[model samples]
Each structure stands twice: as structure tokens, then as C-alpha cells.
Target: MGCSRPGAVAIVSVFLAGALAMISLVLPYWSKMEIVTAAGEKIEVALGLWGACTSVHPPALDTLTAPVIANGSEVIAIEPESALSDSFTCGSFYDDERVRISCTSFRELANGQCKRREFRGPASLCDVATTASFLGDSTAVVPDATVSDWLSVVDNACHGIGHTAVALAVLSAISASLCGLLLFVGITCGAIESRLGRVGGYCAFATATLQLALAVLWTAEAHPIRYTEHAFATSFYLNAVSILLHAAAFVAAQRHQSLEKEALAAMDLDGGIHADGAATEDKEKAMGSSKATELVAV
Candidate 1:
């Protein structure tokens, strides 16, 4: 059966609201992963490589030393511009086998028996090898596989949780919309029969119940909720809007019932006559005038 004008409007409003809700939920997450890298830079390589490595390995100190001989000299010198020592203090290296290495170093050199030194140091030639040895020990390299596995676990959990929430939201919206439609149809049809009123009441009650259930489920899913200022404000706005829509629906439904009751009472006063019946002549005129007055006031 066709719905009344208000019922049609309600259905359209619900659909539009659902569309907007989906957009609100999905757009932010979509924007978050947009690539902003400079030309020719591998964005994935730049962002993912370090994070993947650091997931399993402890972060290393910023500076280190490596034993390097200058010319034919046995004396080891710290490369002034090594990854470990450069003032720029960025960029990475690949070993002979092309394995990526993130490291740093210090300036100055030492000789003789290498003595161990701290990351920052007083230096003598003998301290060079010792500093190199210490730096070598500071390499906090983690196995690539371990890092990958850790990332996979995190990705899987986030993916599953996010999809589940979206799915639930969609399902809830559909259920709520269908229930609302049923309630609208029932109320409009209720004037014709008592059975229709019973149906309408049942549908309206079910819609409210299901909406409450979905709200409860959403709260449970978002448990231990920590609300940022923005989230709190947005939630408050949504709640207010929902309350307004519900109030409007209730008011409309009540007015519709009142109109139907008055129309029925007028028929009774007209001796239960149809418009074609002679008895309804004066009563029909009075009823029409009363309805016109009610419409104008409304």
C-alpha cells in the first residue's frame, strides 16, 4: 500500500540521515591515509620501514662510532659525516647486501688500546676502538619477520573491530528505518479498523525498542569511552537531533489520531450516514466547517 505524504517524507529523511551517518564515519578514516610524499619519494618506504623495524626492536641511541682507517694508516677515525655523527642527523644506509641500517656516529678519532666510552665522551686515541665496540653493542636491530608479525596482529585487530562496528551501525540503521516505516503505515491505516491500530501500536513500540537496543549495543561496543572535546560535542548534538525527530513524530502521530477521532465522531453525530445519505446534509456542512477550522489552527 502507498504511504501518506508525511510517511513518504519520513522515509526519505531516514535514508538521507543514514547516508550522512555513513559518510561521517568513513570519510575521516579515508583522509587519514592519504599520501603526501614529495615527488619520487616512496611514501610507504619512508613511513612504514622505520615503524615496522621499531615495533620489535628497542630504539637505539642516536650516535655511534665505527672503526675506519684513513689512507694506509692503522689509526681509526670516526667519519665526521657518518649517519651516526652528521649534523643533519638523518638518512639511512644499506649494507653490502642491501640490508637497511639506521645508525649514527660521533666526530674525533683515537688510537692505541681501545677504551670503552659513553655516547657522549672525553676522547683519547686509545678510546676509539672501545667506543666503536660500545657502539656496535648499541645496534638495536630486530628481525624483520618479528616486526612484520607484530604489525599484522595490530592490523588484523583494528580491521576486525572497525568493520564490525560499521556493520553493526548499518544493520541498526536498516532495522530502525524499516520499523519506522511500518509504524508510519500502521498509524495511517489505524483510522479504518481497530486491528490496524493494534498493528500500528505494535510497530511503533517495536521501533522504539529496537532503537534503544541499538543504542545500548553501540554503547557497549564503545565501552570505557574516553570522549575528546570534539567527540563529546558532536555526540551531544546528535542526541539532541534524535530527540527532536522523535518528538516531532510523536506529535504528528497524536494529531493524526485526533483528526481521525473527530471525523468519526462527526459521522456518528450525523446518524452514521454516508455523504450521500439525506440525514448527513446539515451534519456534513457542520463537520466540514469544524475540520476547516482545525486545519487553519494547525
Candidate 2:
């Protein structure tokens, strides 16, 4: 057979990696965090490529516990004693495919005496729908052109990078699928042709490279602040695993190509020797026939 067990295993890895990537895309576990609000309410958040979900729990039992509020741009205080396993009401938010920007905006209301800071975090669709119309409307509170321009620049950059990362991830999945098809053909044929093997290896490498870029873009643009207790979840880890698998597939394809070349060289050398031996034997037979004819004629 042209393909060895290692090459077959490599092909399987590509398909497996593709499956993981698909799962990662569908899952909403790219980032997870459990936080406690200043009002003693515990909220658990999970973010994904397409959407996010939140679980809210009732306030802590200990009413005497002093609540600590963070006025700055930092993570809310989390109660160390709180357990994530606790039951709570879970709701989906920002289910739209577009990236969401969670921010806190401070605006001066018509009443000069009251300056209010509005925080927009991950919330259920219902909660978001019920928010005040002017809550997230940037036009409603643009203090000046400079601030508005800065906000626009930041928002556009975030959206661009986030969408690009998602597109790369989808492309990587397609690349992985193509690589898997090439690998299947190679294995079934009992040897991967040099050209086909090269193509397959390139595809695998492309998949890995795309995955790496996806991760970088996601972290740079979509990742929330770590101070908010946010950490990578299973979906991100699955993507990392898929990258490793693609790299392994690329290495296996190279090895298969080398083996194929060596096999072809060996076959060519043996065929050449057999051809030379047959020619020599034919020459000897012709010479013997001529000598016998001369003897008979004489």
C-alpha cells in the first residue's frame, strides 16, 4: 500500500479537527465568568462566536456581608465562597451573529444635578429589549465630535476584527475538509502521488495558519477584560486542539510523500536492471543462432 498507518491516522486527524471546529462554532463556551454584582446578585456569563448566555442567581444568604462596588473599569467583586454549580435562571442574549460591544457610558441628563453612568453588559434578549431606548444610543449622548469619532473608530475596529476572525475560522474548516478528502484518496490508492500529497500538506498548513490567525484576532478584538473574571472556555480550547491536529496532519503528509518517492525510485531501479538482463539474453541467443546456421551451411 502506498500509505502507511501513520498517514491514515493523519487523515483521520484532519476530519476530527474539522468536527471540533464546527462544534466550537456552535457552542457558546468560548469565554466564561462568574461575577457578583454590588447588589449581592451573582451572575454567570458565557460568550461565544455567535451569542452569549447569562445565569443570574439570587442574592447571597448573608445579609450582613458588605457589598463592594467598583466604580472604575474593573471586574465586579466576586464572592470566593460562591459556587458555580448553584442553580440559576439562564437566558440567552445577543443571539445575533454580529459582535456585541459591552461598555459603560456616562452622560449628563437634562437635570444638571444628576450625572449618570449606564453600564451595558451581557443581558438576556428580554432584558435588552426592555432597556431604555436611549441606553445604548451613542447619538443621544455624544458630548463632542472627538469623543464620537473615537467611539466610532473603536467600534468599527472591533467589528471588523471580530468578523474577520469568524470568517477565517470558517475558511479553516473548509480547508480541513479538503485536506481530509485528499488524504482519503491517497490512502485508498495505496500511495499518495507526489503532487496530491503536496497539495494536501499545503491545505493542512493553511488550516493551521488560519486557526492561529483566528485565535489572535479573537483575543485582540472580542475577548472581554480578564479583570471581570473572564477566562477561556471549552470552545477556545477545542480550537487550539484543532490547530495542533492540522499541524500533525501536515507533517504526516510530508512523510507520506517521501515514502512514495522512495518506492517509485526503487521500482524504477529494479525495472531498469530487468530490462538490461533481457536485452543481453536476446543478444546471446541471436549470436548462437547465426553460428548454428553457418555450421549447417558449411
Superposed model 2: Cα runs more than 4 Å off: 1-3, 60-158, 189-191, 194-198, 222-226, 286-298
Per-residue lDDT tens digits for candidate 2, residues 17-88, read 888877887787777665554455565666666545545554545434644335586434334423212332
Please give the lDDT score for candidate 1. 0.35
Q: After superposition, how far is residue 55 of candidate 2 from its true place, in Å?
A: 2.5
Per-candidate clashes come to 6, 2
Quote model 1's TM-score: 0.33
Native-to-model Cα distance after best TM-score fit, residue 113 in candidate 1, in Å: 59
